[model samples]
Target: MELQVLVLRPIFFFFFFVFLTILQQSSSARVLTITKPDRHDYAASARWLVSQNSWGVLSTLSVDHKGAPFGNVVSFSDGLPEKGNGIPYFYLTTLDPTARNALKDQRASLAISESPLGTCTRDPMNPTCSKLTLTGKLLILEGGSEEAEVAKKALFTKHPEMMDWPKDHDFRFFKLEIIDIFLINWYGGAKPITVDEYLHAKSIKLASFL
Candidate 1:
């Protein structure tokens, strides 16, 4: 009886180990499959990515003798569409030459990226930065426009420090009428998304969160 008990104990332990190994592999496979984002979800993720960033690289065409690409760090605010509208937009205050050049060219791109926060250093192979580049026409608002007012309020709400600046400062309000947005997850392929598509995606995500 004693010998039989010992033999059964070894068999039970071996099966238990095998069962746990199979379970672990199954969970790992599910995780890998779930990480892929669909078109709509990718757009929503892009908007969420922009919302999380406060600073971004504003790329513009040079107005000087050389028609080079100029990039500058700028503080920006994302615009939420009106009650029924589903367009993606953003606003920023700029008086820099790059901004002027972009306005003249009417084409510009903003790259918003977020780095992982915490004490741990990021792995080089797997960077902690998530980026989204939004391409659009740069429109300057000088005179009174309802859209201008709405943009100003949104900007102030996000960055109250801008309110301390003098009213006559060369800093002017500029809006980016987003035509296409591309999100690169860890420097992957550029996923193209339209304004309406992004908004619709965002609505779905918000619903899920609620």
Candidate 2:
């Protein structure tokens, strides 16, 4: 009786509680769910924003706009839902100014926000609504290469419409070779997440920030 009551019973309850806690945490990390990470966790916050958002503003050195900064709304993918690879891939048409400008000059940036995920209680511009800007060379992927195949899978899995886009429209695959990162998820201004930190991030965790 003493063994059962003093050791077994308490141990059983402790394991049960731990199991329940893990289940709840796992449920919160679902693909479509956008529970923001801790504000101080800059890398996780940036990765979370990139993984959750399907579209963003792609800024480039505009050929049409006479060298001014040009921003175009575009759809992109980092990877499959919860298992993103942390690099934004775009399916673009050369007929559009974005791809056209990128070809002329590779310097570019993609900005994404958490507001589209529908988890932010504050205004879209509110500090709590995380945002990330990835700056790098926007390079076009070679057709039929291995990385291009990965790009195709990542894009098609996220944006099904791309598979049906007009094949003759010069739509092609592109990726942002991120060299800089600027993120903001809380009140203290942009968080310092490095390009290496963002790309190698396997998951959104505070420890992954390093």
Candidate 3:
């Protein structure tokens, strides 16, 4: 009886250890799964968010002594997405102080958002808000390059009134070369998208931006 009891005790301990190990692994996997975002869902939602709004806040660092951040509400013309390019690019004109500061500093961020249109009362049909944040470096196009010409033409097409501005004046065309992009859909419930995934899912042709 003593021999039998010792053998059973060792077997029980081994099974118990295996059970705990399996439980720990299961818990870890659950945590990882919860944290991971669904790339497909994020990509689709990000595209929708951009399509919903034509304007966004253009944020740039101040070039003055303060070196603070400044945001401006600007009207933007949307660019179509191309494969390997994340969300579409946008164009807007700015001669304001913010633009000048950004030109001197080159680092900037752009944000676009959309909220429930009518009353504060929440409706199931429109229970959520969305926003996209883009971090990139701004490059000022100078001289007579084909790219500059195309940017000018596209700008004019979006804003016909701009044509009335004097021709001799230096109208700087800025190309935002995106470095990192993030999209939060349904206020953080949906998955988030990184710049690489965005570019991979969409195709942005140069002609479209031009």
Candidate 4:
């Protein structure tokens, strides 16, 4: 009986370890399985970065700091998952310095990277990792308007918690009217993609990447 107990103990531990290893591999696979657009397709690549990401750094000229550039981490959405318009929408309040700075100086930019998407196998700073900066004016939409309604749906769908945020805090919808786009997806310098090329680029179908 003592011999049987000792033999069974090692067998039980071996099986348990195997189960844990399998589970860990499965989880990693799920995270690393994301498919990104080809780096050569500049417009599609830029749109992909914006669509896949839920947040980015929004930089505005600081009103308090005497026109110095101020960058803040902000949550944003282009549209529903796999459906994006290439325009970034944000939910913000005057209570936050970012919102206040935008109101004072509409000139701003939103920077997004592929690092958070888990598709980048290289260092985030590596050129192959891909990054984008959309320079434009940040404008607050009217409380009740056709465009504002669209913004609300686009935002709430991606970030459900925004729907429950404190109303009294006065969070309003804002959008970056992209005037210039800077993208780097490969070893070369910035891509020569025009604004029209980006906004009117073929909409990325989820099936294409999958």
Candidate 5:
């Protein structure tokens, strides 16, 4: 009886571990990081990605390519972390083609990803990793305007280097007037999130606590 007990205990433990692992995988096919909000909460997920990420691909209609899509890596801010208004703001200079192209054609898009958060275990392109693309007119903020003031504070607080950039670089504050928001946060297809949903989505910290 004693020999049987010892042999069965090891086997029991092994099977138990396998059961737990299979159960875990089944429950969370796409694991949400400890810092990340639940994927089902699409609005919160989208807002979290935008607020946490400092950089993304800003896509614009190319001037040199006669309307080919041009995507450039750029730094941006959505207010101060948790205090964000959900609208992405950029500091750009006309010396760069992104700002130059936006001037000619207001149509533009900013694509951000959750991969940068260092939470995703899968490939960056994997749907479970999550990605957001905000499409809208990229409008330049008027200097000395109220919105511009907010933008300046938002940008400088997040990226201090912008403040010390050469004054003659023609650097200006630009914002994505998001007309559409596309978000993929799970195994399912794109979530049914709108610009309003994303803008109004509360901070992940608040949402999780509530």
Candidate 6:
């Protein structure tokens, strides 16, 4: 019985270490994929918010409503997954009032919340939940431009269905030329992240195993 027990113990210990190794790899994968930037790092936090979200409220001066503020839920991408450039790109058609509004007046702001990312446990209105509003000029890209080509790839990769949308709808690519950034990630008032900081800051480089 003692000889049998000794032989089984080594096998059990070996398997136990194998299990731990597998578990560690799994946890590391989760951290690399979903880890959010520290809230105090305002620029990184802002970029993370923009990159993680696929859609947000894009507000523009309404052309049909006598210049009133118009907010429309729109899909946008900053870049390919985990490799965003901190500039929001959109596929829009003039048939949509939001796109028509942008043509008349380029001033716009995109508001995104941490709620959709599922990282916020508290009420979305809570300051700790984090929110970003990028105010900028919305400009359309000329067809076949180099920047337009890049924007198309970013949009299509993040939103594959966009590639299949009706081409006759006059959908064009537009980007937000961000001027001001308002971010609330913690308790105090909005963080004072400048446009340059937000754009040039090192974004969180979380690797995606998926």
Write down the lDDT of every candidate, Cα atoms only. Answer: 0.61, 0.85, 0.56, 0.89, 0.87, 0.90
**Model 2 clashes, total count:** 0
Scored by lDDT, the top model is 6
Q: 123-168 in candidate 2: lDDT tens per residue?
A: 9899888788899999999999988988999999888989999989
Task: Tell me how candidate 1 scores on lDDT.
Answer: 0.61
Residue 65 shift from truth in candidate 6, angstroms: 0.6
Clashes by residue pair, model 2: none
Ranking by lDDT: 6, 4, 5, 2, 1, 3
Candidate 3 achieves a global lDDT of 0.56
lDDT of 6 at 15: 100
Question: Candidate 5's residue-wise lDDT over 12-101, tens digit each?
Answer: 999999999999876554323236778888888888887778899999999999999999999999886557898899999999999999
Error of 3 at 101 (Å): 1.3
Q: State TM-scores per candidate.
A: 0.65, 0.80, 0.59, 0.85, 0.80, 0.84
The regions of model 3 sitting more than 4 angstroms off are 1-40, 80-94, 116-127, 187-190, 203-210
Per residue, candidate 4 scores C-alpha lDDT tens digits across 42-126 of 9999988888788999999999999999999999998876567889999999999999998888999999999988778999999
RMSD of each: 11.5, 9.3, 20.2, 3.6, 8.8, 5.8
TM-score, candidate 4, is: 0.85
Q: In angstroms, how far off is 197's CA in candidate 2?
A: 1.5
Choose the strongest candidate by TM-score: 4
How much does candidate 1 score in TM-score?
Answer: 0.65
Worst 10 residues of 4 by lDDT: 26-35
